[model samples]
Target: MTENLPFIEITDIIQSLANKRSTGTLELSRDGEPTTYLFFREGMIQHLKAPRSQVILGKALYQLNLIDEADYELTLSDYAQTGRRYGEVLAELGLVSEEGLRQALSFQAREDLQNVLTWKQVQTRFHGSSQPLSDVFSESDLEFELQMGGMSLLMEAARREDEWSLVREHIPHEDDVLRLSAPGAIKAEDLEVRITLLIDGYRSAYEIADAAPCNTLECLHQLAELVREGKLVTLEPLELIELGHEAELDDDHEKALKLYQLARSRGQDGFDLRRRIARAHHMLGHKQEALERWLEVAERCAEAERADLAIATLKEVIELYPTDLHLRQRLVPLLVANAAKADAALQLRNLIALAETNGESPQLLTDLMNQLLELDPSDRPTLKALATLHREEGDGVLAMGRLDELATLEVEADRLEEAILAYREILEIDPENLNARLRLAESYAGLGSTDDAVAEYRGLADILYNSGLIANSINWPFLIRVYESIVELEPSSTPAWEWLAKAYIENNQRDLAISRYLGMAQSLRPTPGEPPSPALISPLARVVELDPTRLEVCYELAHTYLALEMRVEAGRTLRQLAEEALRQEDVPKARSAYQEAIEIDPFDLVSRRGMAALHELQGDLDLAFGIWLLCAELCQRVGLLSEGRSDARRALAISASDPRALKVSAALEALAEEPQAAAALLLRYAEIMHERENSGLALEAIAQARRLDPARVARHPLLSLLSTGNTPRSGAPLR
Candidate 1:
């Protein structure tokens, strides 16, 4: 048995003992906290005791609401006065029955075990003893012993820990206070409701968790859920400070600053406030603002005893005035006083960079580099600055040597790739350096051996997807190569196939992607009771998007949909195929496709259009005209005037005297600025009306033609005699 808990987990220890059917006591301790003891009898947890008073069986009963507060107080008093076990005291006082006491003890033991499992930083020791913990358990208590399965406890603890990690993000600080936003509107289960009712604006989340009837983690999890559901809200720490007692304002500079920030946001402004704000900023490591604000009151920050602030302010000011050596000279003492050696070195390096930018003298830059190296002898930035200085002085050999040293340092710091790139730079200068080539190859192999290229490509894909560039034609070639590589390396990879299919669709290779997906689906043999894989559905859908005219793809898609018992989707795909067939003027195919579509969805428009188109193609003129008229009316009713006009034209081409067709065609012709065409159509309408013995309507149609084109109507033989109430002779050419 392991005596100490260093790297070993408590769960592992418990599970090992249970597997071996060992009998002993396990003790766990943390510094300044009382030790927890667990007694096992033949691998089962016979009893457990938590050091915390909250885990006592009597307290657990009170928390669980199995006993009232008065009963709990009496039980505690009797146990204290008689030195009897708490469960015995509860049974003797009749506060709880033997069965209720047993249940409470079991609950208490589970809570203790859960708490013990979370003690990752604590010390644990196990002692193998022949004697049972007779001191802790009486004979009657042994009869109702709380036996917990170690494996179940371990699993529950692990689940709770995972849940706690998510919950902690929302309720990050224990000091965070939450208040009920809408007490009346919170509709939750009994446990959540109980936790919600405990939430008051004054209590911290930790307090609410402690006061709830469940374990602390369970209470917090419910609280986080309530917050997400908008039934509760967390109060900011600054807001809590205002709601707190007045004495909280003194001594704590951080809290005072928060209060002042709140005040400023509320429109409180003055010079005193600014000074206080500046002082707070200085004390809180906001170095730049402290100096600027102090300079407004005192000419120099040194007068305010904040030399660090002065140095930071000078750095900021020097960025704007790089040639100001006096300011740099003033910053030196403050930098030394503040122990800012690296920052001092950085300031000198900045001056050197500025001198290079302004094309200053090399001697001046050399003096700056020497001063920088004096402050921090191994400053890489200053060393690089010196290297630049040497290279500008036409010292190529010295510059290359400096770069070699820097690369060696990078390698020692475990930046192998950066070192390799530096070596490549040397080869760029020399070109025949075999050592540089070997090192670069070694670095490349090292990175490739990690097998993170797939992950890197996945990350790149994510970036492109987020940036809305994943579907860009320019990125398609690179994305295709990445996805193909992943699939080639990991042949059974589903995500790779999905990404590759997407790339194919975006790159206009939909048919190829569809074929690949169908092959993939054929390879998968689904379980007897399960649906087909979603991977099969994606590529089929992409094919339809690419070209809905592909009846073969539609057939495969519909079959796949039917295999998944998705009748509605299957019907939709069939309708797409039927519409595409109708568009291609394949009458027999359209008729067959429409029959199938109508069987799936009787009211679908695709089937209606297919049937109408089939009738028209078969030359059943009257029946076709009637179906076209119905289609026109449907289109017109749905505000599709262009489609309505097309249908009406089709009907008129089949039968010249179709009433709806003539009316729609005449109107469309007038809108198209063809007044003579309109006049001719209305004259034909009049002839049709005249044949039906509707003389009044025939005269009305003639009047409409005259209004459309008076000159054309006068020239028309049938329409010219409209005012005389005379019809044209039989077999007269209206044209």
Candidate 2:
């Protein structure tokens, strides 16, 4: 199907054909351009041909200095005479090697495809064929034919088009002249530098494009980039005049002077132009005729309601005649009435600086400060000067208030260092200001001034700690910084050390946390022959409580608890250590941990079970079975029937003939609503117990089985004979 380029972009069409694995000759053409044919084999681009252009393989080779002009001419002559392919002739004559010819042809094909891809407006059609056609060069001759895929071509072309658009923005007209502004700004080997050397003041962009070493589009794109980067300047006809007029209108006299100099080269000399030029010089602080011209222009601009332009015209005059107080008087009211706060502030600051130099009255300075404040309430420099002025006027409260406002504004603006200075000024007025001190500390920390932050935090800690206001609160992050700084300053302080250890844990510094915790433990250790403080137990225990998986930390906690003679805590810590070890499958470590727990609390059944489980994992069935039996018995004594059943199953797994395990299993079975299975298990258990000379227990087991299914027991010959002499009731004890 035929497709329009705009509706489906050329890249999308190419991608679609590739995805469909279409094999055919795809023809692309644009109006007024020769048709280009692309041959595809199994969706991969095999070859491409375009109407002959100067950028063909032979010319490319010559341009790249790979083949001499003589060789190129000779090869062409040979091809014309023999009617052979150009690359084949080049290969046959050894002007270029087979590989070199293939490479050149590949480059030629890619360049042809790239040229086609840049066609913004084109028509496309695919001509399907059942059989592929043979071209000038066989596949064997050009084994390295361009394999540029659809996606790669799309990306490259899109990138070039985007860059071309940006370049066009800078060099919009082909008639624009480009000249180098900064010859030394770019490297000598840079493409921009080479392009810049080609630019002369008289050559238009179109002429430069024709003379470029590469393709016309690429050369134009490079020239545009150079213009945009300010390395090159585009000089269109009358641009200087337009710029000069613009500067003159904006009252930028300095810029106007520069523009007018270039504009004058175009023969723009007239009385009115010379007069404006003189006025611009005068506004730049020049003399005599310039000064007269500037005064006239300033008045004319003012009458035209262009106050900004008039003010610009007068600023230079005021600089040349600083003693001209009348000129200053004229500019000040215009500045204020125009609502030009920035310009007014500058003029007022200058006036104040001049007055202060001349020893002007304090009231005059106060008035200037008030004017600056009215212009911009949050102006930092103005507020700073106002604070100093208010303090000198014996208004300390007002001065401190201004400093506080300045600090707040600075903080909100993310000007951390500026806020720090403002807060320092506030503290200077009231050294005991807690809020200012705290803000200063926070700002220091925000700016990564760690040592300064630490100092401020230590000072705040002293104040808060002395007031008894330092307690655990939701503001733990702030308190953490305070205590951390305190510990750094007073490493031996017990409270600070304790709190810092907790802080480290809270901050997720696992390594530092363990170290700090150890330090606290050592500091809280009692002297020889003295009982450790009960308070020391909590921090030591906290280490394990924070991360029970830290087996080493848990071990240390247990040892410390033992040293403190806190037996119960010691046992608990060891049990936690053993549980953590078992969870990690560290059998040897678990064994040791459990053994220690048993030493601390010999009746710790959890530890005993852990040891048994460890033994079971090590394949020691006898030991495992013994421990499981003991656990089962203890659970049964405690009325933990489910746990007893679980342990009994473990023992039965080790030895199916064990009477105790069989009895527990059978009872559990009965509870589970499987009387038939329970009775069979009990009958087997009674047999085992009787064989072991445990007749009473055996009879008890048999009676339990009978209670489960009396009829089934009566039919079983062996069980009936065993119970015949006893004739025991369901509730009777065999013994």
Candidate 3:
């Protein structure tokens, strides 16, 4: 095992680099843990990369309240599209000021450094670069590099560690709860109100630290101080025990053990508590004391007539002590008496092995094997022994039954060759056993013996057909070849023909697929006003796939896809059909196609846009406006705000002077929570109305803008002209 080095040694390594003014990347790694990378430039720590634990800049900004959810999501979307750094994206989006970013970056660095200082046994390597960091890192990565003095950071870390050590006695664990000694008692000497308000006797120190706006280290230190001053206290031992029980129930044995130990040290003790402690130990690793305690508990449970609980306790002990012969010997009879014969047989087998290892007599071996086989017939050793015994006695029929069981087990274990030999033996004894023959065929298929499997399946298929049960036997994949033979033998069999065509499709021989269906379609053309033949669905779809000019076939394929509940495929088919309809100047057909496409896949942008266009061409401006606005809202929801804006612009273009259109455009901007953008669009609408000398509409637009941003509306240049009932002197736009 690698021993932990002193923390001072790590600080010294970093300090020596600062003293030498070295520039490089220092990588720290530990066994089975993620590596940490620290970048230095002219002796200053510029960046730290810990893939496992680094706090991303965007998350830091959000945690610090420097950016809200809407802005953060938009920044992520913009960053993903542009491949830019998060800090750059935040600044580009104008969501965070320079100072705010600086603070967030510093917070990120401090949090990462705190994590680094906790590692004491990491192997370190420094790759020195002759080139400056500006050249070494990409511009995007270097643009927001943190400028932290290495020695100063080390000193600060050391100071925090020292303070934490002083407070460790009171706040030894993050989950240690703190409550006010007297409720409503204010201790304002040095504590922040946020910290005091969070001391509601429920939240742990880590939770309080997370809930507060301040750094974790500072919040923890304040909480520790409160405990030291006797103004706060930890949870009582009983309460701690309750928490440990809760942790145990949650399957967190490690945490539960720690809490239990802490409670024990605080003078909590009882027989039931000791039993719980023993169970926790057993669940964790089955220590010697835990085994002994559980054995004692099992005896007491038996004395109390709790057979189920006693059996469960003994089973737990046996799982950890599988080789303890006495334990299994004791457990087998109990399991048998409890009507758990399967479990009893398993334990009895273990006992037999222990007896053999101890040089006990083999006199009971046959009887034990017989009993085990009665409970689990698939037990390989017992089945093998019985088969050998029956063969030695010349009882071939009884021997074949044991062989059958062994063959099933071998097949389940994927020992197909062994299973095949056993099945061949069984067939020799009973040549007409169709079940064995079917199993042999399936085994051949499983082993990739396709030709052999096909021969067997074909024979079985012929027999089943003569027996009038072929329909029930053609479901296996290997039977597809049987269907092929049937199609050749009976050319007039429609079901056989259909099955062969489907098999051809599955095999990707699409050119050969649906041939019979195409023949049927050709033979039976639908008369006028009569429903099309159902068999034509496949052929029509195939025709549309081959030739896009088959408009009627395309419509039939769309209906077929819908009937099968394949809506996505149906929507795509309809969209293509709509595009073709538009090319043919069939406006009504195009509109119906687009409408069907939208109904199937309401979020499909292409169909919605096509439908909106059709509505516009048909002189239904109101219907067109609703679809365009819906498209904008959908785009915004998917982080395509720019596309959403374009959609909103399309809506505005439909009816520029419509008040509802202007308000709808403003609402799209509000989706991004940008009141400024929303108010600007409203103001732009007001300006356009004033230029048209429409005072009433212009005032209405100004009133809507005021609702979004009163200050911007109050200071607008056109506000005075519209209020005084005069057109703007110049039509210059208000930005």
RMSD of each: 33.3, 32.3, 32.1
Residue 232's lDDT in candidate 1? 75
- Please, what are the lDDT tens digits per residue for candidate 3 over residues 300-365? 677777778778877877877777766776676678778899889878778767766776544455
> Please, what are the lDDT tens digits per residue for candidate 1 over residues 1-735?
435546577888899889987787787787768888887878888877665645777778877778987787788788789888788787777778867877787887787778778777667777777545666545654565567878888888889879888787777666567886765756666346667667767666877888776667778887887777777787754555464323134555554555555555546544445456566666677766665654443234666786755666666655544675655656765787688877777677666676777777888877787787678765666666676677779776666666676666766777777776676666656554545554554454455532333333344455456668675332346657877787777666667776676546444576767765654455453667877775677767766776777777777787678788787888777777777776776656667767776677665555666677677667676777777777766766676667666877878878877765887777766766678887888888888777766778888988989998998777866654555666566545454
CA-lDDT, candidates in order: 0.68, 0.73, 0.75
As a TM-score, model 2 comes out at 0.33
RMSD of candidate 1 to true structure, Å: 33.3
| Top-TM-score structure, candidate number | 3
In candidate 2, position 460 carries an lDDT of: 76
User: Candidate 2 clashing pairs?
Assistant: none
TM-score of each prediction: 0.33, 0.33, 0.38
Worst 10 residues of 3 by lDDT: 1-10
* TM-score of candidate 3 versus the correct structure, residues matched by position: 0.38
In candidate 2, residue 428 scores what lDDT? 80
